[model samples]
Target: MREKAQESVKAVLPVMVIVLILSFLIAPLSPDIMVEFMTGAVLVIIGMAFFSLGAEVSMTPMGERVGGNLVKTKKLWFIIGTGFVLGMMITISEPDLQVLARQVPSVPNMVLILSVALGVGLFLAIALIRILVGFALAPLLILFYLLIFLLAMLAPADFLAVAFDSGGVTTGPMTVPFIMALGVGISAIRNDRHAEDDSFGLVALCSIGPILAVLILSLVYQTEGSFSPEIGRNIATSVEVGQLFFEATPDYMKEIAVSLLPITVFFGLFQMFSLKLEKKTLSKILIGLVYTYIGLVLFLTGANVGFIPAGNALGTVLAALPYSWILIPLGMLIGYFIVKAEPAVYVLMKQVEELTDGAISGKAMQISLSIGVAVSVGLSMIRVLTGISVLWFLIPGYVIALGLTFLVPKIFTAIAFDSGGVASGPMTATFLLPLAQGACIAMGGDVVRDAFGVVAMVAMTPLITIQILGVLYVRRETQSADRSTGVEYQVDISELFAEYEDDEIIEF
Candidate 1:
């Protein structure tokens, strides 16, 4: 319990400080606004504690256990079918996906949501199959990404930007911890010693499935719209922060409850028939679910109320300045700090460092993620400043990443992909996106074309940064090999005789 509190403080306290600093920088906050922001910050801290506790209690363990049990099936198709259905269902429940769906113009919300979910479902199934079959991660990535890029070339021009962004936002906080835990669980089922190494990348590859699926959807819709950036989101003054929380509270709580319902029902049915979970265990998990629900509500409310408006206001004020080029460096600074505050990232980086026995340290991973997200933020702000095609950056970026897939270590290939999804946390959507949107508005650009892909850019750079780490590791290995080759192998017979004489060798 103390641990969870410390974690929450470490995560939420920094953001609260950032908020206070921003409030001061803006027009001197009225007294009411000051109190409201403070209250919202408190709520956010409370929410992070609940959400983190709930995830540990319910989400991660449940997914891991279920994943282990589900993949025990001898029948391959059954596992695939389960993966497909679960992926689709989870995406349908993802708040971030719903948020992205609403922003997609002309497409019916349900239709687009369903399509994106289906894309996730189909790819998730394939990802599971890859794990089970024990395919090399590198080659598989090359093949699938090659197809994705090829499809992008032929895909509708208007839909290109949207296609890539789907890959980013679909794997937000709600989906990452559970899905990554599930991968760990499922991979543990493998008898191979390398199974632990293989467990790291399921979310990574699963993220791709959406990109490919969306590009296909794009083929059906013509999206050749003019490109411009704009941002318009409700900004809360200190007085209005509490009001924002109240307004956002009910919807997120209801949505989160509904999201968990199907999975719980499925677990209940499975337990009744097959697993029969012990009373104590069942009770604990149920309690954890409650924690998750409470946590998500608070987290969402705080993010919408305190985080989003503050970020947008700051971005708008900065972008409107004559020295708007400051947006890039400012974005990099914000990106560096923003990642540390994302709750799920702590879970992931800790797990990786532990699982690898320091082969990959959390500090190193943190540094890589910081650099990646920083570059992404800079790129995103540039898009806000000038309405460049998202493809102009995305295609080249993905190509370089995919190219690195072949050159880097297998584990890194997986980690890189997962990092993309992991990087697009709640902060990205609730705060950073709004910031870009606000900047776009300040610049009078089209919001959908320009601001929409910030999440995509956030998701892209990690794929490269982590892979570069992998490349470095491989180079060190090569250097070590070459150095070892220079050493001569010789028998020190006289020294052996002297050592043997002193030891009085027993075996002889």
Candidate 2:
């Protein structure tokens, strides 16, 4: 746990330093706001550490146990039903989703929230069934994205960005650990060689569900109110900064409680009926849940109260500069570091490392994700300045990403897509999105069209960059094989599939 906290601090510190430097040099902030930002940074680091540890100890295990048990039942309907319910329950409780719902204009919070929840639930079931039946992930990905775009054409123009952003935000800190583990759990039941590869695309598919759901909902229920970005409250005194956080703390505590309740109740029922976990394990999970709750409260409070205001202020300042094009490079730099700070990215990297038996290193995954997010943020800033339709980016980005699916190892495709969702975690929602919103407002651009797609952009780039890494990975393996003197060894694309083909089935 101490080590994990240290890791979280290391991950977050670079971004904090970068922001401080920016504030000092380019965007001078008020002292009170600066202090609040610094305090929030501290809280975020600590909260992330605790949350990461807690998720590992509790959420991951619980999800895996439930998923594995359901698969073991050998009743298809029961497995699908459980998966759908679990996905909905966990998604509804995602704090990030709630944050997003609040920001979107004219849509009732519950209406948008439930639509996204249902999307996740339905796709999660499909993901489970896909793993069970050994369905090809790439084909389904292509098909669904086509469906998403078709729905987008029919939906309101302003809602396009929000629909795609919904997809990214739905798979956040709370949702990632459990949903990813559920894939692992369900895949554990299969004795087939491709089970490992199948464990990956659950997140990828679940993400798609929300985009499609929200786009369809947009067509049916048009938003009438125009988006109006909230202005951050000014802190009149230095002491007010502390008071600001202190007062907001209770509100977040309540929010976190509400967010965590559904999952806890569902887990409790699962424990009572299906898992019947040993007392020691249950005790550890309980403690971990407490840690998770506290960590989330602090994290959300810090991000929403501190980071959002600072980000908005920074964006406004930067956009007001004579040379505003610098926002692109600056946004890129922040994007690179910010993704490293995402708590869920750590979870995804760790899981990938374990699943692949060190074939794909966590460090490599981190670098790929950083590069991807960096490009995304840069493009997003361009969009904010120009007010271009998101379709301009989405169309080509998905094409390149999907094209690479055939060229790279199958696992890379899955990991790449999964990384898309993970990269756009809480930090992007709380900080980067606000930054874009501020910039959009300053530049006199449409907030809904220009600012709303930051999350989508963040989500899209990983699909391409990770697969590019996959190409290099294949190259390295091929060269290594060719260098052997005694025997002529050939590297086949099928060899990449060999890792998952091992018949060793994991047992709960």
Candidate 3:
């Protein structure tokens, strides 16, 4: 547990150092805000460690067990029905979704939230069916994205970026652990060689559901409002920073309790009806749940109270500088490290390492993800500076990613798409989004049109970069096979066949 906590600190420390350096060199902040940011960073590091450990012990096991049990019954309707219910239940409670819903001005919070949840539920069912039936991921991706774009055409201009961003934010820290584990559990039942490949793409499919659903909803309900920038409150004294965290604690506790209830109840009922696990295992899960609850509360509180204001302030200050163009490279640099701080990235990377038996190391996955996110943040900064449409980048970016899908291994395609959502977890929503919004505001750009797609961009880039890694992996394997064949050719044919002389000998 202590080691996990240290790992979280290491992941987050680089970003913290970058922020401090910026504060000192260029984007100096108010003493109060700096104090708050420092305090929040501490809480986030601690919270992330606890959350990661809890997800390993509790969420992963529960999801896997439930998924495994559901498939054992072999009832198609039951599987789809359970998938839908579970998807909706888990999504409705997602902290990142809640944060996103609050920010979108056009749609009513409940309307958007329910729309996103329903989308996830439906797509999750589709993903389950695809796995069971052995459908190809590439074609389904092309088809659904085409549908999303068609709906995007009908959606209000103001809602277009928000619609796509919904997909990225919905599959956040809480959702990824459960959904990824569920895929593992379901695919475990399969005896096919592609079962490992099938364990991925569930998150990828679930991500698309919210985008399509929200875009359709946008067309049906056209409401016009603007995102109101959060006004910074005056802090008279440094002590007030501690007071701020204290006051925010109960609110997050209540929110997390509400968010966790449906999933908890659902899991309990499932266990009673089907799981029937041993007492010791159940006790461990319960304890882990406690850890998850506490960790999430602290994590969200730090992010919302500490990071958001600091990010906004920093962006505003930097963009107002004489050499405002620095924002682009600065954004890219921040992007490289910010993804490391995301809790879900750790989960996905560890899962990939384990699934591939270390053939794909977690370190390699992190480097690929960081590069992808760096490009994304650079593009996002360009959007902020110039007020360009997100479509310009997204269209070609996804086109290239989908094209690579055919060229890479099936498992890489699945894992690449999954990494999109994992990369845009809570840290992106809480810190990067606000930074973009702040810069957009400074540049007099439309916050919705310009700043909102940062999450979507963050989500899109990994699809291409990871698949690039896939292309290299395939080449390496081919070369290894060739070298083995060459070594075989060097052996004496007479000697090779000598051992089999007593039996029926075969010649090439």
Best-fitting candidate, scored by TM-score: 3
Mark the regions of model 1 whose C-alpha exceeds 4 Å error after superposition.
18-39, 155-158, 223-243, 474-508
Give one digit per residue, the lDDT tens place, for model 1 in 170-283: 886666777888888789889897688688777777778778877776777655444322222334464354455677788888988877786787677767866778999989
Backbone clash pairs in model 2 (N, Cα, C under 3 Å; residues 3+ apart or in different chains), count: 1
Q: State which candidate, 2 or 3, has the greater TM-score.
A: 3
- Per-model TM-score on C-alpha atoms: 0.88, 0.93, 0.95
Count of backbone clashes, every candidate in sequence = 11, 1, 0
What's the TM for model 3?
Answer: 0.95
lDDT (Cα, tens digit) per residue for candidate 2, span 220-299? 77674366554556778878888889999998898778877887888898899889999999999999999888888888
**Which stretches in model 2 have alpha-carbon errors above 4 Å?**
485-508
Instruction: Summarize candidate 3's per-residue lDDT along 1-508 as a digit string, tens digits.
Output: 8988988888889988999999999998888778888888999998998899988999889888988988999999999999998899888888777767766666688988888899999999999998888888989999998888777767787777887898898897877898999999999999999998889999999999889877887777776537776545678787787789999999999988887787778789889998998999999999888888888888888888989888888888888989989999999999999999998888899899999999988998899999999999999999999988888888889999999998999999999999999998878887898899888888888888989999999999999999999999999999999999887887866677776755568443
**Model with the higher lDDT, candidate 1 or 3:** 3
How good is model 2 by TM-score?
A: 0.93
